[model samples]
Target: MAEAAAITWALELAVIEMFEHICIESDAKVYVNALAATIDDCLWKIRALISMSLKLSS
Candidate 1:
């Protein structure tokens, strides 16, 4: 679970540092869907990745 979160952070860094376009593939539907949706999920690890992702995009 933490490894998944770590991957999310790594992806965030990759987006922020290098890639202009990125595609992510994963077997974990929950995490994938969570990233796609705008709903508020309060789990800290997930939220951290979400925050980093938004930061990267903005």
Candidate 2:
């Protein structure tokens, strides 16, 4: 679950950095839903940061 979130967050940041929209296709409905829900702040922050870094790299 954590890894999936990280990947999703990274993809989102990348899409943002590219100034393009993103449409994520995933089979993990629970994961997707949880992203919008309040849970695991530390994991979310870490994943968000990683995603931002990935976006900046490109």
Candidate 3:
């Protein structure tokens, strides 16, 4: 959840800054894998954050 929150926050910042491209690096392999999956497959705890991150990233 914490990792997801950090990613979400970073993505939010990138969106606010109008960045054309961004790269995210994390040591949390499990969370990274979760984020790579569809929202429906996301863990319940980080689902909302992941959704928001995906939206901001796109």
Name the best candidate (by TM-score): 3
Worst 10 residues of 2 by lDDT: 49-58
lDDT of 2 by residue, 1-58 (tens): 5656555566766766785655556675555555555455335545554444344434
> Under the 3 Å rule for N, CA and C atoms, how many clashes does model 2 have?
0
Better model by TM-score: candidate 2 vs candidate 3 = 3
lDDT of 1: 0.66
Which pairs of residues have clashing backbones in candidate 1?
Answer: none
What is the descending TM-score order? 3, 1, 2
Give the alpha carbon lDDT tens digit for every residue of 1-58 in model 1: 5645765677877875887776777786666776777738635557767666556655
TM-score of 1: 0.59
* C-alpha lDDT of residue 14 in model 2: 73
Comparing 2 with 3 on lDDT, the higher-scoring candidate is: 3
- Stretches of candidate 3 above 4 Å error? none
Candidate 3 scores a C-alpha RMSD against the true structure in Å of: 0.9
Q: Pick the candidate with the highest lDDT.
A: 3
Give the TM-score comparing model 2 with the true structure, all chains together. Answer: 0.41
lDDT of 2: 0.55
Model 3 Cα lDDT, one tens digit per residue, 1-58: 7878888899998998999998899998867887789889978888888789888988
